[model samples]
Target: MKLRSLFAVAALALLVQVSMVAAAPVVRENGAFSCTFYNDGETESWTGTPGNVDWSDAQIASVMRAMDTIAGLFSNEASRKVNVSFVYVNQTIGTAASAVPLMSTESSPPYAPKTKTVWTADDLGGRGVASGSAASVNNLEDVWKYGHYLPSDYADVVVTISSALHLNNSLYYGASASGIQGFQFDMETVILHEMAHPLGFYAPGRSDSKTALEVLTSVKSYAGSIDPKFFDGTTTVAYLQKHGMGILDYPYAAYETNDMASLGVEMSKDGSHISKWVGYKDILMGDMALSGVVRRNYSDLELAMFKDMGWSLANDPFVAVPEPSSVILSLFGLSGLLLRRRRTA
Candidate 1:
């Protein structure tokens, strides 16, 4: 009887150990960023009610792969902890997936340990906090000036994917980039694009590129919605070195228009994305997202943009393939520039 009882206890212990392993949450790391996840499948933040589905093992794995790709790309070690939560919602076709970076309830702590003057500007060009000490902007602007988020800030960039995306065959949730199907969107690529917004590629674009040029031509300065000096001096100088001093017709980066779309969606353009010129059609940060194209890596120009926004690269910029040649002519091209609008918050 004693021997039989011991066997039963040992079997129970094994079962518990397996359960713990199965229940472990997804966590991925890189230089300064560590992304953790919360699977809020049943509780809908919008409705205050429980949903029918929860995140499956496959879904969690898919999101984890996306984080791995992002973590590998950035090399900064400022120690920013990002919390990603998943929720399912009913969205429209071609709308695909949507994500928003929410500011944490916690107030941002002072910028310290390293003292670099951080510059800030207003929508109307009244640049404030010109340069005295390290401070926290308490907004996405902080991500632009500092390599990491403020110490007191909630260090999280939240994302919400459509339940239909994972449930139906709408997304290709495989690890291979070449495996994406013509009828499906690459889940990893989509998530990567969404993640870029919080990491710093976010600005409502200018009214139009034409308007941007007119302001530069007349005033000989950038008067777009975003400050012309948004990029740090290092990035701007490096861009000029690769391109040329005379090549700047408008702002170095393309601007998007804030417009209303068919789905009652608000389309925010510009500084948030690369220009949708001929060569940039498939660039990760371009305004349009095609169905089957896999834009997984950052282009050289996009890397410079990130560096200007204060993110340190984990590796050299544009170290991977599929990076396009410099967009000297494309930056100023005005024809056939019309592209599909995306809704970002």
Candidate 2:
């Protein structure tokens, strides 16, 4: 009887252990953003939330840390919230990862005026529209003219990450401790890049033209000359002037000149990123992700671009006020502790 009881107890303990291991991972939240990871239910190699494919605890934590870092970059405005659902797709989805902006808002007329007047008659005590011009008295500037007021709302962006590509977590946990290794892609960097896309860093396309102007007018005319407000020459000039560069020369220096080419301020097809002009390498928006090690932080030029996009960095310590060394040291220590625990467990 004693032997039978001991056997039964051992069986129960084993069952409990298996149950604990099978439990789904919990959702993680930081600031105004909440992340829920899901798996496609087909991949045999990955692990995480049950019914969802596998993602190790460390990988999930690293994603959360990436979110924290991005959240720190923006100042709170109008209680806008963002919920990111990170779905692990089985196949490659265009450049390792992609983000779809679920919702976005254009600022009132002062920021995105519908027409430009070639000539105004102040002599007549009232402005007059040029001949054949569609100029109206209701002209409003782009959202940026409002001073750091971009789209702010709950669940503004939804991102999907590819499970097909092997991701490196070392850089996510502080690359110094993980040591440099070749070939593996940095997951955190990818997340940061994808996150920026939803924050108003996107190529203007027909979809925007359709939805933005549909309600206002039935006209479906395609206007290629009207540059994206964020990427226009006006904003670029301001950004260049901030760095003491000549505005006139920026078009040549900052834009690409070949077929399928565009502003060099945008992602470069070659390895050289926009930051190269400013003497930095591996900007977050660079077209290609190179093998071997890469830095986790955005370059000064990248941050300036965000500023030009109308995001206020007044609260971001990385912009002007340097983060205290002690905070960084503490974070490193915590990361090490978590890694050690993960290894031992």
Candidate 3:
């Protein structure tokens, strides 16, 4: 009887060990970038919930492909590496989703907790690191500006997507953005957008107080002219002056606020994103995305912004997306087809 009891206990221990191994989160690594997806059907402590929803097979496959594509975008390019942790949870986010750099430590005086900056002199190619440069002066303008790159050993950012997306079937999880349908949001596009934030396209507590009309008034100054000199770093003054909105010695008194309206630049209401200004809506970092639209390329302006933020581009980040006219025509065709189907039915 004693021997039989010992065998039963040993077998139970083996079963528990196997289960633990199976419940581990899935990790995907690409060069210096890596993403950890928590989709196993088990309770994750990070979520602060009992049991997390498991990502569907299709969802997992689609996101895995997106990770590969995003990895390629920064392949061998970042001056430093980053790791991100993604979790789907049943919780309230500021929006349907959010991305935040994981808190970290800095070796400076006071030794406050802060992430390292990604846009260091090495990545910016010494562009804005000089004295009196805009980039260096405002490096610590905001509370969150202490650093941008999350620690590489672990996830520097935690990207949280509401489980509501899963329940509502709101996202199109196809491998290609071109396959997006009229009623579905492109999954890859959303991922790319959120990824840009932690990759150094973020600042906290800033507000884009300008209305669309106010921003439009200054559009002609910088619409067609993009120069490297425009990125010296003070709000949009450096950008505007280079394109003729202001003179070389534009007065310093006008920069009292972070509003870029005077420079024809607009950001989201909360100042968390670049506004989808007319003729520049195709930028990947733009604030809004409509259903059936696939925004994959970073505009030249965006690349300059990243450069200002301190990252080295390994490959040319510019790629032409479908023209606005072409996109409108395709949407019209899709609408007509839907109308015909309704009539026939």
Candidate 4:
């Protein structure tokens, strides 16, 4: 009788352990943002140093904190809760990771009232919609009904990170946390940039060569109803002439000459990517990710661009006073003119 009771207890404990592992979603929350992470069914592997660390859980938690920091940057409460899922892919796409819009309102003819709910999915085609939740549905509709500019949904924004990549773990910085030390490539920076795409910073057309003119032109034409002030104070022609084509044009071809292309020049697809033209070096949304450094914060222009996309924002502490170095760099690209490189989609 005693032996049977012990055996029964052990079996029950084993079953419970299995159940916990199966149902457990590695989740982290900070304020308005919550991120859930999963494996892409690939045998998870991390190369180089830190051989014994659980990279997936640690990286996912780090990513969640990064998302939370981004959320705090904007003062407005997210009308629809933003849930993001990170799936670890074992293969390298190109640079590190890529983001795809799982669902979005059509660009042409626009939606009624000019506000539409957009949804993004994971690499596995999982749209992060909440199951059996009326509040989720109601919140999604509220964003559209009120003509809110930002894409609002209670569903998850699916992001995929490469498990095969050597992500630097030494340097870490995020909205709510910082100074996490590791020697690998900064995973936080890559995750932050990719996640921003589903939030409404996207360019139309293929990934290889979406141009700044294409993005500005599209916004100017289709999004006018949503944001009338998009081009109110800005003149592309003057901007091009003053700043030079390299500032706004990707794959910029002054080739052998100093004269820049016309204002509406075409280059790479927008992908909601900022041109290496304006604030090239420090901003999070630029075209390249350097190893070892983490760009955990967004630039003032990036925040302004979010506002232009129709999302409400909080007062930005970073831009209240202009940094003199940035001002000088903008006035003159003191560094020699360099063409923008393509990043992971």
Best by lDDT: 3
User: 247-345 in candidate 2: lDDT tens per residue?
Assistant: 222333232222222222433322123322432344787656664545466666566555544455645333434369978998999999999999999
TM-score of each: 0.56, 0.53, 0.58, 0.54
In model 4, how large is the Cα lDDT of residue 318?
27
Pitting candidate 1 against candidate 3, the one with the higher lDDT is 3
**Where does the lowest 10-residue lDDT sum fall in candidate 3?**
133-142
Leading candidate by TM-score? 3
lDDT of 4 by residue, 1-345 (tens): 999999999999999998655334456777665565554332211111112123455566667667766767655545555555556554454557766443333332222222213322210012132222111112222332233335533233556666556443333433333453444456677777886765545543333322122223323222122211122112333433554532234333333233233343221244356543442356677666665566777765555445433345666432345689888886666333432222322
Tell me how far the alpha carbon of residue 86 in candidate 1 is from the true structure, in angstroms, after superposition.
2.5
Model 4, poorest ten-residue lDDT window? 44-53
The backbone clash count of each candidate, in order, is: 8, 16, 1, 19
Write one digit per residue (lDDT tens) for candidate 3, span 132-223.
21121111111123334332344456777777765676678887777877866677777778867655555432232221111111222333
How far residue 43's Cα lies from its native spot in candidate 2, in Å, is 13
- Cα lDDT tens digits for candidate 1, 1-345: 999999999999998897654333345564434554444334433223333345666766777777777767655443355445455556666566665554422333332122224444421022233443332222333443233555442334546566576568777777677878787888778888887776655532222222111111111122254332223234433554555432233323433432111011011333455442342233576666787887777666556556544455677653434435435456535333533222221
Candidates' C-alpha lDDT = 0.49, 0.46, 0.52, 0.45
TM-score of 4: 0.54
Following a full C-alpha superposition, what root-mean-square deviation does model 3 have from the true structure?
A: 15.8
Model 4 regions lying over 4 Å from their true place: 1-23, 39-57, 105-154, 166-183, 204-215, 218-267, 276-279, 316-345
